[model samples]
Target chain A: MTRIRIPPTLREEVGGAREVPAEGETVRELLDDLMAQFPSLRRQLVEDDEIAPFVNVYVEGEDVRTREGLDTEVRPGSTVILLPAMAGG
Target chain B: MVSYRDLLAQAKAEIDEVDAVRAKDLIESGDPVIVDVREQDEWDEGHIGGAVHVPRGHLESRIEAAAPDRTRPVLIYCAVGNRSAFAAKTLLELGYVEPVSLAGGFTDWKRNGFPVELSAGLDARKRARYSRHLLIPEVGEQGQLKLLDSKILLIGAGGLGSPASLYLAAAGVGRLGIVDADVVDESNLQRQIVHSTERLGEPKVDSARRTIEALNPDVEVVAYKERLTSENVDRILADGWDVIVDGADNFPTRYLVNDASVWHDIPVVHGSIYRFEGQVTVFKPGEGPCYRCLFPSPPPPELAPSCAEGGVLGVLPGIIGSLQASEALKLALGIGEPLIGRLMLFDALNAEFSDVSIRRDPECPVCGEHPTITEYIDYVEFCAGTREPA
Candidate 1:
């Protein structure tokens, strides 16, 4: 199963699971599975029905934004991480 | 069953033997050395009876003085355990295999029925030195330690230097180098925080030194009671400082500090205050760019307002100076992202902090490829446009 990890901010809606498994052939499908499981996170990740500009999706530590923007393929047993742009002084 | 955060803490806690009673027992039996890894303010308030103070950030460098023997067992603790974790890790990296952390830190020690010695710290006697800093969310213990371990050079002890030096010293920078040739003047007390009204006729460095020393005895205040010109800019900046604060009230000394800091490969924490507003930037050589990249040549003197000509608010320096200290500490600790490529602007009247984006200039004279300026230029000559302070 493809794994979808949650950030601290979004963990509350997903039953506090640090990571959850999803079934999908592509990154978009895996995200849809995650959103279906925890509906609140979908709005933050996808806005106006699109992925937020600042919310980045990374697969294997590489930004998926540079690949397919969100439709990038996801293989079974792969890790998907979502993070906000870190900016603090 | 611990979570990741708890596991990280447990891992750190596991390495530490947090029992102050055990530490007291160890000290009683002469089993280990108890090193207080907090800053001077923390150390001054109180520490274990036999504890030696060696700030965590400077742990690797000043280890020998605090713990003379390499084979002696050492127990280190901070206000809480986080910094001690870093201190213990640093010692371990330095081949201090026998050292262990005082788990839960001093905070836990007191909770566990251990006695805590109190220091005045932000609880200053006169208006409390740095009481505002304690209120800032980002400027707490982690920030305080960064302030303490930081090594910053202040190029002047006048108006701008007044606030910068006092706040930095109060925040607990381990070493502060003050360079100024002028003696304290009655007019200076209106702005320079380091010089008191009673210190009217004393050397500016003397006034500043006594202020910081009396405030936080943990800091090593060095005074270079001479004007910073081309002759001594490089020689004086030989301390391998982490940041250089240019609070000089003049453009020539300002450029001199920037150029020298760039040459030494240190971040120039530049702050220039005029009337109601101040501009600050971290010019790190070869990283984003140097000050020369933004202003290749010095401004034609009269255009810039000297603190004397423009008249600054007495409290304005306090705002900018504290900001300079914050930036310096952040640069030293290697924790949070640095303001290296960013310029923080403050408008006192409006009370606004706007971060302006700054990018590397390939055409920068100092840090650019095929750089024309190879060495520190003479400020006197450069200002005169006569012969570049040679």
Candidate 2:
């Protein structure tokens, strides 16, 4: 199971859980499992079967987009971070 | 007991001595560490071109710092070679391999027309004002002077700008340009420390200028009582700046600042806060990835909320803004590693700080090799998702 850390802005969609555990070998499988559990997250995190352009996923501190995108492998117990551009100053 | 002349003669005989002509040749040819053991006042008047000043009284304690490698040749000098002979003897006793005294000192060198470097040192007040900075090896006299000569333009005077402006002013940043169109409100007192209750209705730029000037008179504040739009960005940025501190409240201004900074070739210290989280980074154009590289497009308005709508922790901006000030100082001084390609995220709730690498995207429109968007566009409409960004 990989622990996916949720940003504060997206906490509402995950019942305010700071981190939620999901089971998958790749980022695609992890998000699939997560979206299946929390249904609302599908629209927020994915668009047209790809990670939303405005949303960035990091697998173990490395941006998944820089790696293999959704196909990037996720090791057991690895931490995943979902980040979006924040424009509040 | 021997007389002073007898002691002097013995000291001179014990150490190697070089004439002014020979000293000049050695300086021109070899990398000798020159030590000027004259008093502050005398050294400030004039000294050798590349000499480190260590007064006679501080010779034993400060010599190691001035010349760390004892194996290197040390050329010691005083007014007339008398003091340097004793200084050379001291260096020899301290295990220096080759310590040579000037046979005729600075006086003889000056007589022979050797170049002398006059010190443009800080005044007594400035020395005392920046004493802590002077004590740091990385931010010593030179770095402090650099700070005093630097000019930074801040995009806002609220929230993040409060702490950033205050710290930069206190640090003696010579000139500061603050741009804001809002007036201080009672609600802003919770976080905008640069504005006081008494100046509630006053313009934010004016309030900030007053506070910064009162804190440190060394800083000159240029107040712009207007918002930063695409129309005025060019004219405002025309007044040259060394670095920019972006603390804008909305996405429009943020994108405008980024685009202008890229075109101007200026480094920007960017900070933003929302609720319990804050992000800080240095977007240095031509050196690393720009804002466009990090966030190619602004998130939809639903996902992207302003600090006003979502609310931010009182001290969140303070923490983020202070980091921006630190990064700005590092950029101005050219010391240490600026956060050029790293995005630092601070979670106030968890009290955790994490960073991730941000690489320049080859397809970035602004900073990429083949750019499409050459001129500034309607940032407001663009950030609103109404108009597509090229």
Candidate 3:
């Protein structure tokens, strides 16, 4: 269980609340619970059992998708940030 | 007495010319002509669809005929608007009513995110209806919805189709289909400004399809490179197309398009531009004056002009074709009063567009009570044009 910080772009849907607490033993657990709640973020975040390309989800300013297969253990109050890479012409 | 757009020099001083956004605004205001003064190459890349291209490099030579009235107010634009400013000032000096310069050059226009057209061959009409649409409250959003939900079929990739096609694409029409069997030609570069030399030898449909795709993916383009003859006209018309805009230059195919639209219960947004004059009308057979109601019969085959004979003024279609696009958009949007019973006559020579209402003919064939065109039949004789096979 830890606190997850939503990005500014997506803060509106989460009740304008910058941070929220969730119960999850691992990254996978946390993401599953988040997706179950928001639903729309699943397509943008997950694909083929891994984080989708262009997406960067960080735990305490650290990239987690690269280090572990969503099994990164979380402390009781760790903050997560979801960000997607930007591209332009 | 003359426009600076066709200047012989590289752009002497900077003056704002009419870019597409301001041009569209003036067009929406219900008056003013959009005149482009870019070189042929620049125009081919992309110019305002309905803008008359006089080429800044050739201003003095064409202004007299392009804007015959020394007193007519015109908005001008060039690559950066400098040449056009020169042209506009010269026009003012010449006693033309008024010549307003676009705030920036076409490049500045693109940078500012304004609409410009890029259809090759004949650009179909792209003008939006100027009157009364904005006055209606019930139609605002609902009409835009209808336009987004509708699919219009455009015949030909030449002058008439170019403007029409570009406007429909920009106006956010849900789906648009371009049907043509020819490829791009250098001579067509003069008036058929949509296709670039880079796309030379490419099928007209493929060229138009790619242009639409690059410009806006939201508007799905279903291109048919095959000739739209009577044989397959029915099948193509049956695709639940909301409206059919006929730009076919020849008689047989034009009639074929008309008959198909009538049978399919789809409206026909009709447009045709000759040397200096053009005709525009909307047809749904039973609901309004059919194409037959206006022309009844095709002009003699020998007299019809292909790109070769009736050299279209590079910007002539830009005016009429865009109107066709506007009419099609209005029909789809259901926001404004459709040109259903109206005929628009435009004269670029005088830079004037006049409108007249047309009445349905009860004695007509297809849409008339006792009809002659029932089953899908051949129209080979009508499709005959003396020009090279297109």
lDDT tens readout by residue for model 3, B1-390: 445444533233423345556666777784666678876567778876567667666667667756676666677887765667778767766677768777566777788786767735221221133113322333332344456678999888877787788878866677898888888877566666557788888887788878877776668898888888767887777777887877776666766777777777888888776556667878866678776654444444332334344345778778778888888877776646778887666667667665655557676677777887686555445323432122
Q: Rank the candidates by TM-score, best first.
A: 2, 1, 3
When 2 and 3 are scored with TM-score, the better candidate is 2
Candidate 2 stretches greater than 4 Å from native: B1-17, B26-35, B49-52, B56-76, B82-102, B381-390
Best candidate, DockQ-wise?
2
Native contact fraction, candidates in order: 0.00, 0.61, 0.00
Q: How accurately is candidate 1 docked according to DockQ?
A: 0.01
Q: Write the per-residue lDDT of candidate 1 for residues B1-390, one digit (tens) a residue.
A: 767677556557546555667766666776787889898777877777656667777677667756777788898888877778767767777777678777677877778776665543333442244446444445544355556667889877765677777777776788999888777777666667677778888888898899889988879998898878888887888866788877766656766777777778888777766555666777878777566655555533333323454456777777777777667777766556667766665667678775545556576676777678877665432223211101
Worst 10 residues of 2 chain B by lDDT: B381-390
lDDT of the candidates, in the order given: 0.68, 0.87, 0.66
The clash tally of candidate 1 reads 10
Candidate 1 per-residue C-alpha lDDT over A1-89 given as tens digits, one digit per residue, 9 for 90 to 100: 78786644345678877688888887788888888988877656765555564355767655565568677888777767765321111
Query: What docking tier does model 3 reach?
Result: incorrect
Q: In model 1, which runs have C-alpha deviations exceeding 4 angstroms? A: A1-89, B1-149, B380-390
Tens digit of lDDT per residue, candidate 2, span B1-390? 999999999999999999999999889887899999988779879889878777889899878877899999999999999999999999999999999999989999999998988877677799899999976657766689889999999999988999999999999999999999888887788899998999988889899988998999999999888988889999989899999999988777888898999999999999988899989999999999988888766666666666665688888999999999999999999989999888899999889999988888788889998977788765443234211100
> Ten residues in a row with the worst lDDT in model 1 chain A?
A80-89
CAPRI category for model 2 = medium
